[model samples]
Target: MSERTVIPFGPQHPVLPEPIHLDLVMEDERVVQAIPQLGFIHRGLERLVKTRDYMHFVYVTERICGICSFGHSYGYSQTIERLMGIEVPMRAEYLRVIWFELSRIHSHLLWMGLAADSFGYENLFYQCWRLRERVLDIFEKTTGGRVILSACNVGGVNYDIDNSELAGISQIIQKLKRDAKPLIKALVKDRSIKDRLVGSGYLSQEDAVKLSIVGPFARASGVEEDIRMFGVGGYGELAEFKPQTSTQGDNYARVAVRCNELLQSCDIICEMIDKIPDGPICEKPKGNPPEAQGIGRVEQPRGEVVYYVKGNGTRFLERFRIRTPTSQNVAGMVQLLQGCELSEVPLNILTIDPCISCTER
Candidate 1:
């Protein structure tokens, strides 16, 4: 019989992008169980709603997570728009989708870089991030911010991309798609990469449903769940939309799902640019919201993010809350960790793409 041992796996590890602590119960090299500990970096951002006016709170929301920054702002703005009865122009909605999908591409590339690094593929990691830089460049040229884009406002977007620039952006996205093909192929199809990822952390489709996972994590487990399917805002304008999915429910499936979404996001961006209408981008919402509650949901790169706002018929909101994807996916992450080999622990945790800052916020 092997002796049981308890091992602390984080709060500071080489492979982890954020601080997340997990105590692993080990029987030899196998993990019997994993218990997660959070709250190491809570910023109390939600509580700030009482002090910050509803109009300015969008900035705070964008700071919730750097990678998902635009999505946070977009979701918050949608909730406020719904609450205040603001009618954003169709052009703005289309612009919002373009930026949102670009952010998705940026985020998925970032995750792929991190995954490559975890696989000890240094060159591949650099290549992935290098491709991500072009997306950031587009954001900087259009929105004036990279990580924390304050482009979204209460009624509509703050900036607009002209038709010519949109065409150029489409070209860049096409180029990115071509450049990224080989890197994605190497990461997904390489025998060595598959050996490390395939069947490493199996989360059955039944278990995924029982756990209620969201975003690519759930999609990887064959759950066809995506908030975008509701056809809200720019998504509604699209001719077609489908959630990328896989039934393998393992580390490899998670990687493949995200990689495919990267290409899908590029396609969505090009389609929006081609069909985008012309109109005023900002609607300049008037007056404060009534005493009511508003909820907004967005399909972020990691998963589904929900924002709740309670307006008190004043500039300041009565209450604000956010349910980030990491918080929702943590349970599923712990479920995957069980019985995995210790060497595979970091990869399993990375597969969920846990953002501790977003969870703690």
Candidate 2:
């Protein structure tokens, strides 16, 4: 019998941008079990609801995750708006979808770069990020911030784009689609990329459902559960929207699912621009929120993010709660970690595309 050995990985690993520590129990070179740990970066941001007023809390929510910053802000604002019975304008709703899809595209690009780096494909990593910078430029042009956009508010959006600007944005997206094709081809068809990702970290469809996985991770496992179909924002107008999924449930499937969604995001963005209504961008709230509670859900780049707000008819909210995608997907990550070679541990964890800051929040 082989002697069991324990190895501590990360919280400061080179491949992972955020800190996540996993204690791997190994039998020789094979990982027998993975014990995940947290709290290295917890900031108790959730508890800030007690101090920050409901209106100012949107900024705090945006800081939860840089990659999903707008999603968090939108979710929180939506919750407050619902509680206050404030209806956002039609144009604002369409604008929300436009920026949200742009955020998704950039996030997927960032993850693709990181995934490439995890497998030691340095050139591929650079290429992926070089393409991602264009997405960031779009964010800067529209929202005035690259990562954390404060444009989304309780009643509607803080910014607006003219029809001509929206058209220009569409043209830019078309160019991005054309420019990004070569890198996408390299990632999908390159022999070495497939060799590393094809069969690694296999998550069965049944296992994914049992674990309550979300986002591309669940989609990759053939469980169709995209919250966008709920028509929370401008998605109701996007009748042609379809959730991307694959049956393989391996690392490759996850990558493919995200890549396909990137294309879908581009389409969604263009559609939103074309169909956006011309009107007031925001509605002024009438009064303070009454004593009530509401929940807001948005399909983030990661997955479904739930924001719960309880109002006491005061400036400060009585309670605020957030259910981030990474928090829900951790169980699935642990399940995939076990029974893989020790060397494959990082790649398996990376497949989940974890944002520890969001999880630890």
Candidate 3:
């Protein structure tokens, strides 16, 4: 009989950028069970709603997760807009979609780079990030920040990209589309990559639904559910919007799903540029928020993010809640870790793209 033993996975690991600990219970080289330990970097940002006014609280929300900062800001603003009954202009809604899609592309690129680094492909990692820099350059040229975009607000966006700037953005995305193909080709065709990821960490479609998994992880398992399909935040304008999916539900499938989504995001951005309307970007709120409740749901790069708010007819809110995708996907992560070779543990964890910042927040 093989001896059972436990090993600590993280809180600090060379492969991970964020702090997430896992207790792996193993028999020989195969993991039998895994227990996740969170709460390493909780910032208490949700509770700050009681102190910051609705207008100012958006900044706090933006800090919840650097990779998905705009999603948080937009979700909070959407909730506040609903509570205060503010109608944002059509142009702003389209602009939000553009930025959101850009964020998704950059996020997936970052994840691909990190995953490469996790498996010791340093050159591939640099190449992936070099491609990602172009996306950040687009953000800097438009939003003045690469990671944390503070442009989203309660009524609408804080800044506007002129038609000429939008054209430049469209051109940049075209170039990005062309430039990304080679790196993606490398990721897909590399034999070492396949040997490491293919057939490892399988999560069947049935188990995915049973675990209530969200985001790319779920989509990779053949779950075609994406909140963006609801057409919120001007996603409806892109009538051709479809969720990227893969049937294998393994680490390789997750990478392929994200890579396909990156291409899809580029297309979505270009389409939004072509179809965006001309109108005011924002509107002033009429009055103080009444005692009311509001909810905002958005599809972040990681997955679905939900924000709930309650107003008390004052600057300070009564309650605020955030349901981040990583937090919801913890069970799914553990499930993927079980019954896998211990050496594949880091790759399995990376497949979920765990954002501990969002989880602990």
Candidate 4:
């Protein structure tokens, strides 16, 4: 309806870490419509379910997203348990919560640093990554890998946190809380950061809901759909467990929500260390389940991931569907970018923490 030109946002861009292509229909300098293209990296993970045995396919399930590795494993295990009618050991429940929150911490920190990098705040980016190193160290101490810590298993976690490891994790979480203060100030309260993010590329709450945005993207927009609130995994037992929310629905508010959540993650980790009951961490399934179908949803670092599994009485399944957060949030990214300036496009996309690899897969 207005004078316009078409502009391409990315398949490879400096601000984004993954490959997500966007075709922007713009009116003068303002973007009017944004069409997102996914499926580039879709490797047919769902199709693989019919071939791999139920027990052996957990590894394939964990590969949904490298950053959300444990959540993937957790979701897969939960689905299988539902099929087999298995309630895992109580200790395993608490252990799953620990890893879930830890993954959340790592993911938020990684995004915080990337958000800084997007705005050209080099010093802040490096500082955030420095603090994130401590989190990775904890991950390595527990899971043996920094990024892809396949810490989850079918009935429970693969390992246990002994008394010594528990004490060490407690200390590290404390130090992280302390170090995060200055970074939070710079990212959350800094006028300059606010200047670029606040009121820029806003996605109204009603519209975000309409598009089904999840994770920090939705929470930052004042939607509280966190699975943590569902009280799964030792979360229900917490003395204080609540979802973090913000109303701005802009990049700054997204960053603020995550920074605050980093502290909340620290709180969760502390409680887990204190309240974890000593016992066996896993349970043995009785045998192969009969014809069954299960749906599992996990709150990944990016957002909620839904895995629908259908088992046909044998080792393999009939259908496996994974609805990744990035895919669900893709529609919102385009909506937010509409009418935004060329310079604001990159920041807008990054606000969703788009994991193209996970979405395409």
Give the number of the best model, judged by TM-score.
Answer: 1
- Give model 3 RMSD, 1 decimal: 1.0
Q: Least lDDT summed over 10 consecutive residues: which range in candidate 1?
A: 146-155
Provide the overall lDDT of each model, using Cα atoms, as 2-decimal numbers.
0.93, 0.89, 0.90, 0.85
Q: Which parts of model 4 have CA positions greater than 4 angstroms off?
A: none
Off by over 4 Å in 1: none
Candidate 2: residue 260 lDDT (0-100): 91
lDDT of 3: 0.90
Per-residue lDDT of candidate 2, residues 42-119 (tens digit): 998989998997778889999998999988988888888888988899999999999989999999999999999999
Q: Candidate 2: deviation at residue 259, Å?
A: 0.3
Model 4, 1-361: lDDT tens digits are 6787888867888987988788898898888899888766778877888888877778887787788877888888888887788888888888888888888888888888899999989999999888888888888988898877777778887888898888889988988899989999999888889899888978889988999899989999999888877876567778977778999888888888888889999898889888888889888777775687788778787888888888787777888888889888988898888888989998988888999877877
- Ten contiguous residues with the weakest lDDT in model 2: 284-293
Model 1 global lDDT (CA atoms, 0 to 1): 0.93
TM-score (all chains, Cα) for each model? 0.99, 0.98, 0.98, 0.97
The candidate with the higher lDDT, 1 or 2, is 1
Model 2 stretches astray by more than 4 angstroms: none
What TM-score does model 3 achieve against the real structure? Answer: 0.98
Per-residue lDDT, model 4, residue 23, is 89
Root-mean-square deviation of candidate 4:
1.3
lDDT of 3 by residue, 27-83 (tens): 999999999888889888888889888788889988988989888888888888888
